[model samples]
Target: MKYFGTDGIRGEYGGEHVNEAFFEGLGAAVSAHLQGKIKGRLPKIAIAGDTRFSSEPLKAAFCKGLRGVEVADFGVVPTPALAFGVLKEKADFGVMITASHNPYTDNGIKFFDENARKASDEAQEQIEKFFDEKISGSGAEASVKKVDMKSHYIAKMGSILPKGCLKGLKIALDCANGATAGISGEVLRGYGAEVVEIGISPDGKNINCNIGSEHPEALARLVKDSGAFIGLAHDGDGDRLVVCDENANKIAGECVMGLIAIEASRQNALKGGAIVTTIQSNVGMDESLKKRGVEVFRSGVGDRLVMRLMLEKGCEIGGENSGHYIFMDISPCGDGLAAAVKLLSTLLCLKIKVSEMSGVVSLYPSIQKALKVARKTPISETPTLSKTVEKIEREMSGNGRVLIRYSGTENKIRLLVEGKDSALNEKSMAELVKSVENDLQ
Candidate 1:
């Protein structure tokens, strides 16, 4: 079976695939690698989790297996906080037990390094291979400890913002009632933004209950009615972001990534003026940025792939159309709050509304549709699917682009279309999405 997908392993809580035995096995395998290689006194690892009901239990199971790794337990923290905790303590690795934007029934673990960055594929591959072992060194090791995982993250998170940066700025934030619920308000407070927070309280069951970036109507209405300058909405684990302007009109999530990319380049934070993203990214971005000589690097669908392309290109910012944005120059893992803060800061520096800033590069119309498959089967293994994809590719060439790929986090196939013509895009999108739905759904 497959343990590592595009991002990480996720399955239903209390299910056979993600039960206690598997989690412990995974931990033991990964820890065995560090035991001999890492020359540290006490092998330490940081831990964190989201507000999913299953996350707490899974985290407990995971930490029990990663014994001897200086374990710190950050309660109901977002994915970024977990990664940040690892970076702050200067540990060998960190593990955050979260499914990240998936519904409440789903839960999984994502690992990061001491730098708060996602673990390299090579390291992850090695761990995957070892997970099949019957026995490992850390399995019988001793010394399990659990400490607070929030303070260090708060300190490091606070370090990046300038003093009084948001002193008089008015903003509204929707925490998605998930991972970043507790910390989102406090972090904004540190910057002194007059932050009006929604979805700040999460009982384990209430994670993404119609209250996230996925459902922005609530936040949008609140932002417009409150006369707020901006609005930021985060997903379950706060790894992705979405935003709105003063009028509560959404700045397309893809536009958020593009805005940051342009800003990073202008600020010299992005090296060589190259930005890495995926084919699913809006065509408008590529068209607009090319005029300015800003390079757009394309990668496979997944935050991990975008991140890899970013490093390979030595670019600071990378992301996808799905809202997953990475700032290699800032944090290793995608941090929604960090991205929000940067976008807010960019607004501060430019003194422009989000709509005004986005007008610099207009987004082209594109269509994206996902079809859920009945079972988990790698798209590469389906010959019929492959042929259908080829047919779509042939039909869309020159006039537009079509991307067919399996979603990293779900049992679904995604069809993306983008081009110069709106009618062609919608027609192709409907055709492909319908075909895929019929074939696989």
Candidate 2:
């Protein structure tokens, strides 16, 4: 009886959880769950992955499970391309092998629906159930085969580029040398930009070593030196994008939200004139959108939540401070390449400069720290942490915010604080985190 985490199956790169046996079950279960519908036609599946070493094995295992099911293997592809392929080929579903921005040692599987959105909770449960009871005993004869992931993905992304000219734009792109190294540069070319692409070469080991959304300082420095209009960085799976403006100043994800929301609203793409983000977003972002007469909607931190609110409110654009932007106008799931294109297009049309929007959302000075703790520890499960957090929230009322949550994939408790006063928030955060750690230990 294997347990599935919040998203999908995940664990160490080569850990027991992601082994061949699990893959075979996962494949067969997913296939069987979808078999009833496929009776009307051949069930089509698409698969892609980041540069993680576990990619091939997992892909192989998944394919093995889909014994009679048809699958198109888009090798070493990004998350967005997997969605594009599914919708382009009109397949039943798509699977992506990635841990997003997690360290290289960790990996995961992301599922996308037939409409190119992240899979729903019900679907995820079904997949896990299948993994719990695998159908095939032998994966060697699995009928899954390979397809040209690059060519199809490129064409699909290219079709979405805004019809215009980016002739004067000089952009530096850091692909994290993971999944996006291939599509980002070529697609920007289709839009007529002068693109200087770095980290496009993936060695499988350097997926997000020191680049991408998790760290854009390097990209910012390069953008300043290169004198490009903007520097774009993506996480390992290509689901999130962080930007650096012309002056080499890093633009946080939430700020980009204000920028994209403003432009989308101006362009009449902001349906219901609303933008969605997690509760952890900067106060400046919500305030900025309100000033522009657009609504700021709050959701849980997961992209799944942001997407749900987007669909519910029909929001044209929504994203996270983590750099994952889910543009409902494009697709339900976050697409780093799509966000890049949309942002670049909007900036070009505005003609003011990326630096201008830099001042749009002023993030509250905040800090997030985590300590490795046992998943079964009292601190995480005990009511004491919640009680302390509530007290902190009340004490810092109208001054700061506090958030405590367990990582869906890791054995750690995260402490997050955001406030208008940096010093106060910093001290408060430190004191609280330390107390929790000490008590738990």
Best by TM-score: 2
lDDT of 2 by residue, 204-281 (tens): 778888888788887987797788988999999898998888888877788788887888788787788888898868
Off by over 4 Å in 2: 135-142, 161-164, 376-384
* C-alpha lDDT of residue 153 in model 1: 62
Show where candidate 1 strays beyond 4 Å. 138-142, 375-397
Clashing pairs in 1: 44-70, 45-70
Instruction: For residues 1-441, write the lDDT of model 1, one tens digit per residue.
Output: 267777788878877667777888877776776675676566677777888878777776766666445565667677877776776667788787877777788888887766767777887877877777643544345455565666666666677879678888788889888877767778888988888988878888777778888888878977987788888889999988888888888887567777767776677776858888887887778877877668888998878778778878888877876677777656777888788877887778777888786687777777777778876566566656656666666776776677777776677877777777888777777767666665676
Q: What is the C-alpha lDDT of each candidate?
A: 0.76, 0.78
